[model samples]
Target: MKKVVSLLALVMLLNGCDDGNLTQEDINFEDIPTQSCSINNIIYKLKDEESLLLEIPETSFTNEPSTVGEPTLLDINSANRVVYRFYNGTVSATNICETIPPATPIVTDQWSAIAGKIQIFTTAVKTTNATDNSTKITGYNHNIVFKNITFAKNNGTQVYETFPFGDYVTTANALPFLFDQTVEQCSASKQIYNYNSSEALLLDIDPSLIVNSATPLNTPRTGLIGTTVNKLTYRLFSGLLTSGYFCTGTIPSTPTVSEEWVATSGVSNVSGIIEVTTTTLGTGFKHVIVLKNVTMKKGTNDFKLGDSFIYGELLTTN
Candidate 1:
């Protein structure tokens, strides 16, 4: 009887080992597969209705044109020419053009134009890991490239300017076992630009301009002020101009004579002032108040504001 009981116990122990109970070391991590994915060479055209239409003549990936969303205006130049960029649903538009034409006009006839090809480049890695009785999958290392084929614009011709689209990476999460996923999808605009550094002033603005003032303003005037800082300068026009009018002229030199200017300083006060200068002769009005020359003092360093501008009117009680 004792020998029989020992034999039964030995049989139970052998059965437990054969029941497929696995230790961590017994799991196969090498069975997991990693895939590299990419998309390339999408084309687009401007529609007559001012909508940017996708044109994918050929592609390396299985993604269709539907995966690419609409193009949004990225920037506008002094000539009224505009730049546009496209991205996958992951990225959002930072800027939009206000005036969209209703008809299909030639690239030259339209206010917005693209001089070169816009392209989006992206890459990602998908990783799979096997867990206890289940599998864990993750996608990571996503990157984006949004830029124009050329940054140099044609002389006297307004063209779209493309910059590096902002970068984004997706979060890693557990996916269903055996499920394939697209880690990233980026759309390239068909439009292009020949943008160079000199044309960067078109995007400059005065930091002090109040965009949400109760009295609204037109777009500010911006231009390459000088090479001292190799940056743009912004001059705000106090009132709205007629449609299609932009402040496009020579930037005046800083005044040598200082007036009885009231000095208002803040602990954070830099040395910039929003001065309203009156011009005796102007385009539609005899007396015009122009916002001129923004300078900021940071500690011992004085700096000029750049990269944007504003134009608007102020309401005051007489």
Candidate 2:
């Protein structure tokens, strides 16, 4: 049965409606306005409203350094400006601090005068240190499963496939990509969807989405590049965005022009057919955060790899 399913998938890949050549629009990255927001001097931009997937060629590593004694002040110098990274197999946070300084540290739940959070040393969670400390490995080595990715309709927004992205090989092989849907949010100005389905996790772009190893241009958009939220790893089972045209719909009669993002992967040479004249446009990317250890309120095949995740991945800059 699974083979039949795989064969069906293969058929879908070969026989799926393939059209629309995406035209490569020359976008000036510098032209996009950069907004800065930071906690503990760890700066991050909400990715401009027009900026779809801002390719972060250098932004990488969100170090939750747990090394001994105060978790060692990770320098926010390198990563403070960008967000996102890519290193499969064992997707890690920022390696701002290349080596663990001497010994491992502990946590107090009291990170500074704040009595609620404590800092710790390098463990399975944090190994490097440089930028900020968010989740001690928010999501890693996870099996991305989407049980109720409710699509709009047969012709309405529909989800084709939802699976896991094993891990980044880090070699020269093309990173398996799912040009599917954005599960998270990049900014408040992003396309707000008034869906009939429930939102388990709000969508937003991953700040630490960019990280470079051999690939000079790190595709940091978690919506495309891939990342974790809290723990579980989420990725496109297929491509990320739909190539179909936008159909007009309305919520409370307000009227919304909606479209679908079909998940298709493994194509670097694919071209666009539509001609976009906008100066600033989003480079359609998906931002998803795989959560952990929660109960599935949905149903069977509702949750995979056990624990439930409450996070979001949005179409943003990579």
C-alpha lDDT values of all predictions: 0.26, 0.24
Tens-place lDDT digits, model 2, residues 212-245: 2112243222222112221222222122223121
Per-residue lDDT, model 2, residue 163, is 15
RMSD of each: 27.7, 32.2
Candidate 1: list runs displaced more than 4 Å. 1-113, 117-120, 125-162, 166-318
Deviation (Å) of 46 in candidate 1:
17
Please give, for residues 1-318, the per-residue lDDT of candidate 1 as tens digits.
999999999999998656333332332122222121223222222222222222222322211111134332222233223233333222111112213423323233122244444343333333322221211213332222233422232332322233332323334332211211111111121111111211111212232222222221443322222222112222223233221222334432322111111112311223222322222222321111132333322222222232111222322221
